[model samples]
Target: MFVQTSPGQSGSAHVVVLGNEKGGSGKSTVAMHVAVALLQAGQRVATIDLDCRQQSFTRYINNRSAWARRTGLHLELPVHRCTEPGETMQILDNESSELGQFLNAVSAVERAFDFIVIDTPGSDTYLMRLAHAMADTLVTPINDSFLDFDVLGTVDPMTYSVTGESHYAKMLRDARRKRRQLDGASTDWIVVRNRISALESRNKQLVAEGLNELSLRLGFRSIDGFAEREVYREFYPRGLTALDDLDEALGTGPGAEHVTAQEEVTSLLRQLKLPIDERGRRRAANRAEWFNQVNKPLDVHDILGAPQTGFQAGDRPGPRS
Candidate 1:
């Protein structure tokens, strides 16, 4: 409902793409959370789900819409769309169909919204590559496990040092090269470690070290993202994220995990350095105060009964010319 027409020079929305080669890496979760956070922060945001086969982000938005209608909150929601290619047998035709549809989607919403959060499929497809090139910010969420680390870099088992770039990392390099050549814009890529264990492990340390070295080498920022908490999944049915009003929706103030979820998101947003309005800033302050007043030691059982949120790891940035 708050969608506005605010096309800058190029008449395009600042595209934020959630990308990862491996499934279950939390791309859809991050996209939804960031989009919702921006909406709450008074930004005219839109969303596009290019994961045509799965449509994970699209489904999540639909859930949010249905929940809002049921509750009569009139919560601000972004205009969202899902784009998939035509069922053309020929490779050329399929590619063309996808390119045309993606371009049409961008044209329809770019000038009308401030941000376009795109959730890409796990595989390397034409649409995925195209979206990557258009991105102003590309957020890649990976788990703490080395299996997930395989998607980014090959870490030496002995020294725990990065041996070489992995396949997905190479793909990103190509995307960045193409992006720079086309628009003279550097895609601000940030790698976030998602679903980290509650307790530290030696493997987690090694993965962090690998990511640190890779961040230096590949020109991306890395940081700690969301924790492995059941509360995240509990919010699914309501289509509510940590950014939403918990007391009204859930019949109670945020619990400890909920509070932590809020902090994780707030910190993540600040780290992204996205453009935020004055009202957004004010709401952020109020949210902090409200959470502080309700912040208390929570039992695990109670925390489980409550909820919600995802990505944006406000970490120390390292990219510079």
Candidate 2:
């Protein structure tokens, strides 16, 4: 059972789990950013990638390992683990086996790390549910579209009314109830709207209004997340996060795009209100300054040693190389 921290108390690592049931919602990307942000803050961070099939989060870390080794850069890498569920003749056996594996994974890092960031697959699974129930902070990243909004709540097309709670919302409520019953730990659910369009449109406004209304009923805080940027994707192959010391590692100063990306990460991390080194400080007075402390401009595209074939920048997506 997880214990909640109180005045003059210490306990397990805070688990921030990123999840959503729909694909292309950028769950893995958000998980990577959050993990890296915590790491850059001089905190001990561990990560778990439950998406065994894609393994995107694990792959990102692997890429990071390669980059750090090649450049001899002192980059902060999380103690990472990936779980592979085994097949069994009986369904109950499979569930039990997977649960044991998940618990073992948690036990391995719970005492060692300050924070554990988990990336769940874009579908409802046994492991996903287990991870969700364990989340101290449940971050649900969604695109700024009604299609994406439907995963949490159903909306009326004619009146733009949120008619009822979706399955995912109900699932979270049940998880919260179970958590309270188990050990009185509460999960903070934050709905982050990512990949927002630069151009303001009626659809965006409608989505915002619908989310606001849903927030009232669902009890989740909403925040603006990363805008659709090619910069986020370009660094994937090299395992470079906006929070990295790209200026020093790449032998060039940071560029405008790099600053923008790091600023977004800093702002997001500040919003998360994560626990760091301070004793009972809760949060830094000006955490945003961490990124701004070093601001320089070199062409991000030009510095990327990997093939820049997939993207050309300016918030556009190209065919995966």
Candidate 3:
């Protein structure tokens, strides 16, 4: 059996798992973002992609490494491992192989990294359930619609209220219970409403209400996530994140949408309430202070009189073709 060690109990890495039973819920995207955020905060991070078939999370990390190499930009990357499924025809053998690889990966990084971010598959599987049960923090991202909300709870048609917990929610309850029984550790579950609409609508209101009601029963905190933005899609190609130094990476000043997206990501990270130590807090504070000052228009005296050392303020290059 895998060891059930609570995070911060004996300096073990805290486990954060991104999980959802249904597809197209932005699970990999959130996983990548969270991993990068932790790394940027000056915390050691390792990532495990449990979706051996799809491997979307694995590909994203590869793309980031490639983009960083091509552009010669410093992109922080976590120690990553992608588990492979068994090649055997027997179901039991396949499960055993997958479990061995997963356990090995966890053991290798458990005490080395400050955090371990796991990206689970869209569908239920043995590995997914195992990851969920070990998670110190579980983040579930769902689209802002009834179709996606149904994965967590069923809502009444007439009243638009939460009727009962759905299959995935029930599974989570069981996983959390098992985790407690194993190690007396509590999992902080957060449900993120992703791709939220900019304008208010009746559907949005109803979904919000239903989620609020469900949160009361499930004991999971609900928070807003990324809005429907094209920039998020564009970032995939370059493996860039909202927290990155966009002007230097993109070779142009970031637009208002980019700034807003960055703010959203920062807000979400804060809401996660991860156990960021003093060093991480200082690094994050320093980075925030730099970003705050970097955008202000520079005066002539400030630019002309300054020694030309390395990258200077107000000297960012124009947009790349």
Per-residue lDDT value at 12 in model 2: 76
Name model 3 segments beyond 4 Å from true: 1-7, 281-321
Q: Candidate 3's residue-wise lDDT over 163-204, tens digit each?
A: 899999999999999999999999999999999999999999
- Model-by-model lDDT, in order? 0.75, 0.76, 0.82
lDDT of 3: 0.82
Taking all chains together, the TM-score of candidate 3 against the true structure is 0.85
What is the lDDT for 179 in model 1? Answer: 84
Off by over 4 Å in 1: 1-11, 277-321
Estimate the Cα RMSD of every predicted model relative to the unseen true structure.
Answer: 10.7, 10.8, 10.0
Question: Which digits, one per residue and each the tens of the lDDT, describe model 2 over residues 1-321?
Answer: 012233111557889999998888988888988887765554557789888678899999999878878887656577678877668789788778777877787887776567889999888888998899999889999999988999999988798888988988888888888987998878889999999988999999999999999999988999888988888898789888888888767788888878887788778777766656553122222322332453422122212111232222342221121
Cα error, residue 72 of model 1, in Å, equals 1.2
Please give the range of 10 consecutive residues that has the lowest summed lDDT in model 3: 298-307
Per-residue C-alpha lDDT of model 1 across residues 1-321, encoded as one tens digit per residue: 122332334545688899998899988888888987776664557788888789878888888768777876544466677877579789898778777877887877676566789999999887888888888889999998889999988877789789899998898999999988987888889998999887878988888888999998899999778888888788777778878878878779889999998788777767776645454445445544544676732221121111111111232221111
lDDT of 2: 0.76
Q: Which is the leading candidate under lDDT?
A: 3
Pairs clashing within candidate 2:
254-296, 254-297
Instruction: Point out the higher-scoring one by lDDT: 1 or 3.
Output: 3
In model 2, the Cα lDDT at residue 188 comes to 83
